[model samples]
Target: MKRIIGTGLCLLVLFGYPMTVQSQTLPVVQRFVLNVDYSRFWQNDSTMYIEISTAVYPNLILLQQDSLGFHGKVELNISIQNKSTGAMVYANRYNVPIHLADSASLVRTGSIVNNTIYALGSGEYHVSVIGSDVLDRTRKDSSSFTVTVQNKPDSLALSDIELCSNIIESSDQKDVFYKNTYRVIPNPSCVFGSTSFPLVYSYMEFYNLNTNLMYKITAQIVDAKGNVKKQRAHLRRFSLPNVVDVTTLNCISISSGRYTYEVILSDTLGQVKARSRRPIYLHNPNVKAASAETIVTARAEFEGMTSDELAEEFRKAKYIAQSDDNNTFEKLSTAQAQKEFLEKFWTRIETEENGKSNLSRSSYLGRVSISNQRYKSMSRAGWRTDQGRIYILYGEPDEIQRFPNSGDSKPYEIWYYHQLEGGVQFIYVDLTGFNEYTLVHSTKRGEVQDATWQQLLR
Candidate 1:
């Protein structure tokens, strides 16, 4: 195995930004984009096992270009604090090396996932992880979560479920991935779908099982609204007192969104014993859209929304909102005022059928969900992107003309709307080549229009 670089750095090649100094001296500070997650298991009566998993984007980090292509690195600083005594229990750092053959390979490689495990005494503790771009110290992200690890060897209980990218049979005990005769790869970002990770593999530990007793394990995929989307069950009679189990689900047929990967344990008599649940996000673009049930029930559930949540919803709704409606919301700093404002705004904006208003709030929101699932990019949410804005403001395009990279040309797409303005089309160009296409031209009214759009491809 090759050693990876974490905090150590070579000669600095930092990217510069324009400042009052007027020279390219100051580096632009950006968020070190990544996701950190973990799972807890009983190692013994007095100790607990903690595995920290991180998924980070290689394309998002700053790198130096050379004959070897793009080279960069990221580091994760992990710390465990004992909450009872307000003391630090454990600390360590890990490295992730990134190598890209060229710019185009960035989108295809997706994110790099890494894992590290630690053992700590059974107690309540706070775990913190800080991710940083090794070349740019100012670019970093930090997150923390509390865990209560308890002794479970004498009880019939299951450990915290570990979401994974892969699990394969392995005999290489010396390998860092080797665990319980299998190589388990964790997906810290918890993103799965067709364009992203398609298989959802869950690894968990079962303890204090009776060899003669029959047990049942139920695995389910639940949507954000607590609706079960897919489920299956298995039965087994254990031959060992403690064992590890791996279960997998194919999310290709499921819609993209935030959901829960949950496991339930029960006995032959259907008595529930243990359950573990973790949130996961799926990004299955074009496989399936979000369900209507999840969108339709969202309105009645918006009673206690925070001010930020209310304002964001209004921002999405602003695609169809008039200037006056936006101005009205800008003054609504209070939750109650924003909620009341949105109700009246929707009443005036929702589509009408047979001289009566229908539930367009849910309908519009469904479009937003679909856009977010299909068109999201590395820099911004799909709902905020140019293509997503168009999809929400208008319906789907009648035809989409796609063009991949050709000689002297960047990848671009032309979306045509047959009904809008009699005949209209929107052109998006991948100026960055990371799939963050920008709208350059459009024939539709009130849209960005560039008559010489062909120059952009050149």
Candidate 2:
């Protein structure tokens, strides 16, 4: 049996799942990411429709090979309970396999999106979801949410707006939330950060609309103080009995912080009849990771460092830093702002790992030190080198296969990881005969992959 890492109540799971108020003491699991969202059914006034969407990060799932290419299995469980009566109202359990074009994409930063639809009467209920990797049973994630179902008779109403990290058109393979040829990937946390997710996609349904009447749909990103920071408006004629509206908003330029994405429906008289809101968090990738004291300290630890030294350290964090982050850091006018950015970066990662101790920081720095000592070349430092980067990002490989001066090919090496996303391999080659090995290919998603890599040996 494989060793399972249980995440009882990590903050990431808490943000995405919203399980009952009960909290757990287990550390956060960094292996996988989960997202959940819901859409309301409008066809029947007496019966309320609630469709829940769930997505599993591809990098975290374990995949297997089949005639179709590569795929990973995920076991899912979902349930809804009446909060007032503590009665179970809806429940379901199923399994899904995510497929990819090739092995290298398995480490990519996308997700396998799946949605489930449930119809129930008007009431308040708690929704719960659990997802486990079938091949790696020890790795599982779950979430719980509170929802209400209410459908009034023949009235002009709008359902809750579904927020998504991604939305695309699908040609085949029907699933729930497939409307007008588009599939929406839910962003349960409603948080967009780093560079991986820079767009916010929204979808909603409007019912009992007078097709002849003109209405305005407005979306705004507001701060906690009730001030609108960003807004967009759309004027439409509800020609159909029911209207499904979808919109895409650019969030890459949004500042890092807390905010809410709200949608409001208004008539010609400028009266707000129906409105829905979802909380959102924007992360600033430019923030660097560093050690510092709170305000109590007169001068910060990073305050004394020179600009060149600070830039060098931040550069070493390339494995985790985003392109936008580097661009932002380069434009900073003052050292204080740079220090503050790094502080936030470190704090965010620390929060993700559970603030129980400084073990995460120590471990990462230790790996960096090892990379420098073992993989550094004539031009680059250890962490900056290809071999150093792989070690720092994934830790030590389970096995290393070295092929020096074999046949007419250049010297090469293969690193195997037995416990990462099922299993993966990384190949490095010394193309220049200078002992500096470059990462030629990898079997992990998001990493470089070349099926004809053997040809490069010459």
Candidate 3:
């Protein structure tokens, strides 16, 4: 059987900042972006496992020519100390590598995910991770986190809730986070869109289920206003020591907003056993007026495309097009006129960057692709989403901080751009329980920067 685990999905990306090094011999101050997720797994009655996965950015290190290829690597040294006694419990080291075949690969800023497992009893341990860029030993970063492990209780209980992007039957068990004869793909962001994902899949394990006793399970989709939109309840008996509850909820008709999907477990006596809630964002299409840029009657190569495809591109241009541009496109009588409008549309966003016109167009289209990949929610394409609009206008963010199901706040994310129109940040919140994070506020001029963003988190 395949199993999945979770604490909460935390994504931390580093920005350029200097921090002091612990060692006196190393005078260099370095910045590191690290993201990690830990989940407790029961291996047996006497043993438990803590799975730790770490993602690190390669731009934070220096690359050097090696026999295999040009590579940048980091040595990860971890130490676990007993929190109660302050005694060392375990220590280990692993090397993480990043490789590039050409010097032009310097622009790559992707992350490398590495995993390690540790066995411990039911107690608290302080885990200290020190990462050193192998090519430049002076550049190092350190962070510490605490983990508590415990043996599965003999009584009825539920495992930590895991929100997944995909849960499917596995014939060979190829995925790491597999359990109960299935492969579970976790959505660390916990954001879902209708076009890309129409259903929300959740998984949890019920431990110590009695074969003779009946259990009641309730799953609810609740909005931010404390209203339940959809619900499912089931009563069943289990004969196994561990029974996995996998629920798939249809989100097709759900409106866009911030909401929560909660699972409640109860016994036949009406006593609550275990309950878990996860935040979700739903995205619905929003209507907007077209731009009004002066119409350029000259035809362009885009005229060769089908009308549907041309209309889609114009719809995407809604972000950058002016009101007049919108009016002009709407007024266009021929496909040739629409193509010319697109030519001027791209030209309007073009700049004298490193590659000029082609570069600007390429860059804009690239943002479109990324927006679709990262922010597209149910029912709407990524380019039509709010985040997609901002990304196309402002390019990549310098820093991204995501808070998923944290505290009293709804699932939200903050995007910071150090040099955009004088240092601005965009805040997005999933006000509805679907996975679409609409822009709640922004620091950029002329954009909606709500002063009451704190209240929206609830």
**Best candidate per lDDT, number?**
1
How many collisions between residues are there in candidate 3? Answer: 41
Give the lDDT of residue 118 in candidate 1.
Answer: 77
How does candidate 2 fare on TM-score? 0.53
- Best by TM-score, which number? 1
Clashes of 1: 0
Model 2 C-alpha lDDT versus the unseen true structure: 0.67
**Candidate 3 error regions (>4 Å):** 1-32, 57-75, 99-112, 129-143, 173-180, 186-201, 219-236, 248-261, 267-271, 277-458
Task: Give a tens-digit lDDT track for model 3, residues 1-458.
Answer: 22222221212222232222231122222244344444566767765666555555555566554434455677888788989989887787878767654434433333555556677777889988777877667666565678777778787766666666568877655456556687665553344445335677787877777788888998888864577877888898888868788888776566544468898989878798888775665443231112233222334456467544666677776766655455344323234334544665665556324312244556777889999998888878888888888888877788999899977879999999987666889999998869988898998887997899979999
Better model by TM-score, 2 or 3?
A: 2
Residue 366, model 2: lDDT of 81
Q: Between candidates 1 and 3, which one is better according to TM-score? A: 1
Off by over 4 Å in 1: 1-31, 101-107, 224-226, 287-291, 295-458
Model 2 agreement with the true structure over 1-458: per-residue lDDT tens digits: 11111111101211121122232222223444455666676647677768777666554565555544555678888888988888887666887766655444443435556667777777788988888888777877666667878765577777778877667787654545456577666665455655445667888877888877788899888864587767889888876967787877776665555567899888877888678886666554464212242111223557678645666667777667655455345433234445655765555545554422343445767889999999999998888888998898888899999999877999999999988768899999998889999998999888999888888899
Q: TM-score of every model?
A: 0.59, 0.53, 0.44
User: What local lDDT score does residue 19 receive in model 1, on the 0 to 100 scale?
Assistant: 23
Q: How many residue pairs clash in each candidate?
A: 0, 9, 41
